[model samples]
Target chain A: EDKVVQSPLSLVVHEGDTVTLNCSYEVTNFRSLLWYKQEKKAPTFLFMLTSSGIEKKSGRLSSILDKKELFSILNITATQTGDSAVYLCARTPNNAGNMLTFGGGTRLMVKP
Target chain B: DAGVTQSPTHLIKTRGQQVTLRCSPISGHKSVSWYQQVLGQGPQFIFQYYEKEERGRGNFPDRFSARQFPNYSSELNVNALLLGDSALYLCASSPGTSNNEQFFGPGTRLTVL
Candidate 1:
């Protein structure tokens, strides 16, 4: 079974504090890793990491993958209260047509 | 471009009842996938359809089924619903089967009482 594990199931940080979420996966025919932010019911797409070492960034959020180590990390700098949500990490297998195996997710609460 | 849209934001049913959830993918998208997410857990893959054909399915039981229409819209049917079936059913769409970036819908919260 393909499994994705996230660390620090939940976190509470101040508005200005920075946070890093970790995810490790063991999937067959690994293709890529994707990050999403779920605020209410819908999950908004963040970044899709396919190459290792190279980092992908958008505004204050960034992510990097280490395929060699089979792990990935998402960094959110200078967080705001609006950033409070569940961060999800999913892995796509090359053989499973568009199937995304997701982790339990990390709940982040950014205090004002 | 309207993204992916799902119908009936919320639904309630009882055990042994049947329910159907509908989804319309983004314009020009040819692939649609379904997922079920319980509270506090990430969404789990249920099925994938491309060009009105079923391409893949998850480990869900036979009671759960789905089909895509020629217009690229899809419907998920669950029969003999169990209390455990209460979940947020999500629908996603992509331009192609090989694309990993899928646009997700707002999801339908199904409550089985």
Candidate 2:
């Protein structure tokens, strides 16, 4: 079975602080990894990492994948209250078609 | 263009009851997928349909079934619901089946009593 595990199940930080979330996966055929931010109901797309050592960035958020280690990290710099949400990491296997196997997610709480 | 849309944003059901949730994909999208998100857990893939045909399915029980329409809309039906069936049912749509990112709906919150 394909499995994805995220570290630091929950985190609390004040505004302006920086936080890093981790995700590691074990799958037979890894194709890509994706990150999402969920506030209330739906998760919003963040980044999709396909190649190792290459980083994808957006605003204060950036993510990098390490295919060699089968892990990824999401970094949020200068975190704001609006950044408080669940960060989800998902993996797409080559054989799964388009199905995404997601990690349990890391709950981030940014205090103002 | 509008994002993915789901009908009956919320629902309440009792044990042994059946429920059907609807989803309308984003304009021009041809693939739709269903997921179940239990509290404090990540969303689990249930089914994926493209061109009105079943493309993939997860490990969910036979009680869970889905179908897509010609227009790209879809419906998920769960029969003989148990309390464990209560969760947020999310519908996502993508332009095609290959390597495309999916856009999610607000999700239907189902509570089984």
> True interface contacts reproduced by each model, as a fraction?
0.75, 0.63
Give the interface RMSD of candidate 1. Answer: 1.2
lDDT per residue as tens, model 1, A30-105: 9899999999988999999999999999999999999999999999999999999999999998874877899999
lDDT, candidate 1, equals 0.95
Q: For this target, which candidate reaches the highest DockQ against the unseen true structure?
A: 1
The CA lDDT of each predicted structure is: 0.95, 0.95
Give the clashing residue pairs of candidate 2, or none: none
Q: lDDT per residue, candidate 2, A12-111, as tens digits?
A: 9999999999999998898999999999998989998999999999999999999999999999999999999999999987864688899999999999
How accurately is candidate 2 docked according to DockQ? 0.75
Write down the C-alpha DockQ for each prediction: 0.78, 0.75
Off by over 4 Å in 1: none
TM-score of chain B of each: 0.98, 0.99
Q: Which residue pairs collide, candidate 1?
A: none
